[model samples]
Target: MKRSLIIANRLREVLLNGHWIANTNCKEQILSVNWMQATQKVGNLNMIAALTFHINYYLVGLLTAFETGKLEISDKFSFDLPPISSESEWNKMVTDFISNSEKFADKVEQMEDSLLDQPFIDEKYGTFLRNIEGVIEHSYYHLGQISLIKKLIMQDQS
Candidate 1:
């Protein structure tokens, strides 16, 4: 019933579980692909592995800010996904993404509802709710791309 819980649920609906919106969450989509499928390039679009790393990058940075009260993430480096050359490496990245998603939701869930209105790191960045909601919207945008990319890759292979 609390606002924090509601926002956290939205985060889960997009990232972890709940199929009310897009019919697929990030966890389900990312987990559906193997290393080869994930790394497969489809024209000029970003690969699935790169997108996964991008989302996880923000999750990790936001979690860090939640813990330390400092926001230190940049858009330029968000897609700087390290080489995922092997299945084990891909799996490690997937594991970290899932772990960070849960941690991000948990941190948001535990916050006092009023905290959502407070500035995230500073007044220039807007409120906590704005950033969290931005993540959800941004994720869905990329999720749509991931879905399309996966379908394209599968079609190409067929």
Candidate 2:
């Protein structure tokens, strides 16, 4: 298989399903979480909803860069998760995540293998492959946090 397709599939697996390391994906992890638990502040840790939004924020930024050739995201506003006080709102966030992730994966899949080595928008930002891989790494890092937080929340409820 082509390198671009491999990277694209790997991204999809981590975001949606069948990730090798986690053995599950962000979608399953986020959806399995209770709505109330998502908003709960466990000690100094961030809310699950906030983490979800943070993950998607970068993905959206990368997608926008690919589509519009402009990178307009900053970390300061990345974790600004909307109020998810109701099940419907939480469900909507999850739905948005799924839709956006699908579109992002498709865009990445369409990239040429040569494009991977080319710098992403700017030379200082590094190559497309590096940025893409960074996204996957970032997702896994946060996925671990979400898993631990969920476990702690479950234990607290017990």
TM-score top scorer: 1
Tell me model 2's lDDT, rounded to 2 decimals: 0.90
lDDT of 1 by residue, 54-114 (tens): 9999999999998899988999999998888899999999999999999999999999999
TM-scores for all candidates: the values are 0.98, 0.96
| Model 2, span 16-55: residue lDDT tens | 8865889888998999987898889999999889999899
In model 1, what is the error at residue 45, expressed in angstroms?
Answer: 0.3
Worst 10 residues of 2 by lDDT: 16-25
